[model samples]
Target: MDGSLKEEQILMSSERDWTDLPPNLIHLISQKLPDLRYFIRCGAVCKRWFSSILLSDPPPQQLPWLIEYDEQFPRASPLKEELPFYSFVTGETGSIPIQESHRGKVYHRTGHSYLLVIDGEVISLFNPLTNEEISLPQLPSRFDFIWPVFGGADPSRNWPWHISLVCDVGRSRYLTYYLDRMRWQCFDTVLHKTCNWDGMLFTTEDHGTSTLVFDAASRKELYTIPPLNEETFGFITSYFVESCGELLRVSLDYNLTRNIETYIFLIYKLNFEGGKGQPHWVKVSNIRDQIIFLDHLTGFAVRATAGLKGNCIYFFIEEHCRSDRFYNDSTLWRYDIATGTCEPVPCPFNRCSWFVPNLR
Candidate 1:
């Protein structure tokens, strides 16, 4: 019972193996993890911990990470193949290496952890998290722009993939590709700023004046919601994001006068209580516990967790050239729906997409 005995006991406890912890205890610990980053780290402790963590439910939705990439990288040589990712939860930067086979390709777009890339006659969807690559057949060279819409299942599940591509070249057209079919079928429709909600695609046409609902699987036009009669004094751009099992339209209104630019945001939710045929738009002052992430092409909603703010919209601002002078640098900004205020969020990357990290 002297000093030597006490020291010996402490040393033994310190050397104990963490893998010996019971699976149930490990599951309990994983449930208390604040974010997916910590959950993933906990799993890396040992094989037993990884197995247990996989059995337990994943941690709550974490803040989306900003994925940074250079679109203008020289394609003549295979250089700068790694893409950097910045996490708001941890305030740290991490990167993943792009495969050499996928190098020298044009990065078309990104959504939900997947990158759409074009290489000559091949179009591929690459997920940096899982290192999974899906190659689609090349489309006619006439269409220039492509936007992916994940349908049928959540973005977290990558299997049984159902993707709809919005191909645009002055006129817009829709195309659907299913894993089962392994082919892309074109749907001639003029849809803009589309979002998927509950297996349906909601889109706006005619400059946000009308909302069109389409059955994603059937490729049939269901109905349309009459436009909101609100008036504003500036140029307006609309985006659709699904929130809390409902469709919400976010309008970004901006005006440039005398070399000064100002922005205003307006939110409206699609109300269906009146009836599906008579659905109406209702102005929403608050988003409750949700946060919206938007880039230039698409936007999505995620529930707020600890260390995150709800009722806010985080979006990217691109650099613009005014009067032969570069005025602003590309950056990220947060707009608070409750306060009706906008502020810049610190980001080191210029061109980025919102990516929610997941193991699957």
Candidate 2:
């Protein structure tokens, strides 16, 4: 009792305010906080707390946004029931239905915050940040005979807002949607008429449907490449082609049994622009089987299978006959275009596909 009383009396003689604490100590508290919303609110208590906690980077343990799906291809399960997004961030898998009245599935695009959806007969672009959505009225049924391909460019780059949907209703009719002013422009490609336009729409090797592109500045038709690998219609797939980065193509190989195998692969680089610019596709990897692809950026040929949404390119590091185990533990590789390198990525599922948006 005497010792405790003496220590307390001595400490009371030399005291410090909360502001006297080091910035590191304040930062550690913010990291230990359970939620960002609460941590930010606590910082409002005083300037010392505000500046340190709100302005500085959180500790490593504070980054709670990383969501890892370790089971590559475990089984067939609905995302709503199996891997709900609500439980993903909160660690409590629950449903948070969006009340917005819209049809069609909302998917996470390459840009994490943005969503791309086809709402009913109309196409829509949404940004959850602004809590705003832009929907286009259905195109005239006259042009409904043809399918529409939609996409957006990085807004900061001044890329023209593009909507290209071809209609063979009359002569070859081309319609484009421009967002800068929110309008649609139409052009016709009749053999006798001049084809004055801005961008071109075409398909690529494994892409099931066509791709539409518009020039960023001029808002003019660029070029259209068709997805020629698949013979079926309405089977659209996405591709990513970068001028400086390696080009990767992911597709599927299906035989008469309807059993499929996934592939991840890239093509060899072939310069075709006379060394002035990027190369052009000279030959496909599997021309005979019509399973080869030529990436427009690198002009390399790759033979592989398609993924769920062009998220992965699946191919075996070592070839095996059908008699062998189909899904063996052999090393499977996924090529990252951003890194310009192809490395082995472990896959744990029997038959799974990765969903990646905006490859092209």
Roughly what TM-score does model 2 have, to 2 decimal places?
A: 0.38
- For residue 220, model 2's alpha carbon misses the true position, in angstroms, by 9.3
Tell me how many clashing residue pairs each candidate has: 0, 34
- Index of the highest-TM-score prediction: 1
Model 2 agreement with the true structure over 170-208: per-residue lDDT tens digits: 544434333334555554332111111223322333333
Quote the lDDT for 46 in model 1.
Answer: 86
Score candidate 2 by lDDT: 0.36
Estimate the TM-score of every prediction: 0.79, 0.38
